[model samples]
Target: MDFLYLLKERFLPLSLMAIIPIISVILLIAIWKKKDQVSKMMLTFVTVISLILLISSLVLMLFTLVIGYNS
Candidate 1:
């Protein structure tokens, strides 16, 4: 599928990067819901990890666009 190819082209990592925010949101809700598995420590960890991922993805996207990507 063409979608698979798109992911293969480095967007896979971007997708992963994007998912972190969603996960964070879920964790936030879980915290409010008093889920046993979701804790403040876990949220803090994921938040840091997501920040790193977001920055990396942004840098990569900028770099890719600068170099040019074939349609």
Candidate 2:
């Protein structure tokens, strides 16, 4: 039971990381299937959100690298 708990604690972050790509793929499929104006708009919104997330993650990663190097 203790081992399971420890595993879960370690796995939680990894699971969350895995979700981002799944969500991105689902959003891409939705965008591809979208035909009407509202759907297209929603798809565009999702694309923007995904791009923002990508950029933010990249910036954070770069910051972490810089900080790590300085330390």
Candidate 3:
């Protein structure tokens, strides 16, 4: 019961953090394989957006951790 509670609380932030790296890897691989300039540019844009999301998620996780700790 306690473990389940802990997992439930931490799952969202942790999963977000975990999934970004996988997405980034896939994006990078796609970018590597793609030959067209337009497609590459689009993939690059998406990659940048994913990186921004990852950073924001990290910030959110940290904020949550700090808030949880202080409270």
Candidate 4:
């Protein structure tokens, strides 16, 4: 069940990274329609949040594996 354990460990961050939809069509539409700065700012914010989630989840996974927190 090592694969299952790894999945559990990595799921949250991977899920967070899955928010690319937020940056997808709507973002393109915003730029195409309004050409406003707000959508650009939102894109940056969402991207940062996604990165933070992935990084934090990776750190947690490393801790669990290296320090044996799941033991």
Candidate 5:
């Protein structure tokens, strides 16, 4: 089907975008379990980084959807 073909074409970028949320979830879980100030601070820093990544990924995805790729 046409939809399937389109999905295949966009799979790589979409999958890459998906990875950020998965990582963010794992980081959040780690943060919840962590207790020490030092470790918690470190995990918080990493979680912030993941948040930035998620935002950038969203922007990139939107841009790609609007502008599309060269055929």
Candidate 6:
């Protein structure tokens, strides 16, 4: 039970970090399938933001991992 809690603590953030791009892609697909122009536009904006967040998070994670590995 304690190990499960520790595992969740370590993995949850990494999993969520990894899922950003996937969620963005799913959002983009949903937006594309939407027929309403306004809804599509809103989702497009969200997709862009999600992409930015995904990229930033990936870069940050990579840098941190490299630094930690070296140390």
The lDDT leader among the candidates is: 5
**What is the lDDT of every predicted structure here?**
0.60, 0.58, 0.66, 0.58, 0.71, 0.64
Better candidate by TM-score, 3 or 5? 5
lDDT of 4 by residue, 8-71 (tens): 7766654554455445445555555654555777766655665666566567555655454343
lDDT tens digits by residue: candidate 5, 1-71: 85576567777787777777777777767776764655756877877887887788777776655456655
Which runs in model 5 stand beyond 4 Å of their true positions? 1-9, 35-38
**Per-candidate TM-score against the hidden true structure:** 0.44, 0.47, 0.49, 0.45, 0.58, 0.49
lDDT of 2: 0.58
Which candidate gets the maximum TM-score versus the true structure?
5
- Residue range 1-71, candidate 2, lDDT tens digits: 85465445445444545566567667766776663655667777878887676666555444433442231
Residues 1-71, model 3: lDDT tens digits: 85566556777666766676667667766776674655767877877876787677667666654454332
Quote model 2's TM-score: 0.47
- The candidate 4 region of ten consecutive residues with least summed lDDT is 17-26
Backbone-clash count (model 1): 0
Evaluation by TM-score, superior candidate among 1 and 2: 2
Q: What is the lDDT of residue 55 in candidate 3?
A: 77
* Candidate 3 positional error at 20, Å: 4.5
Supply candidate 2's per-residue lDDT for 3.
49
Residue 25, candidate 6: Cα error in Å is: 2.3
- Write out the backbone clash pairs for model 6: none
Q: After superposition, how far is residue 14 of candidate 2 from its true place, in Å?
A: 11
Model 3: CA > 4 A from native = 1-25, 33-38, 69-71
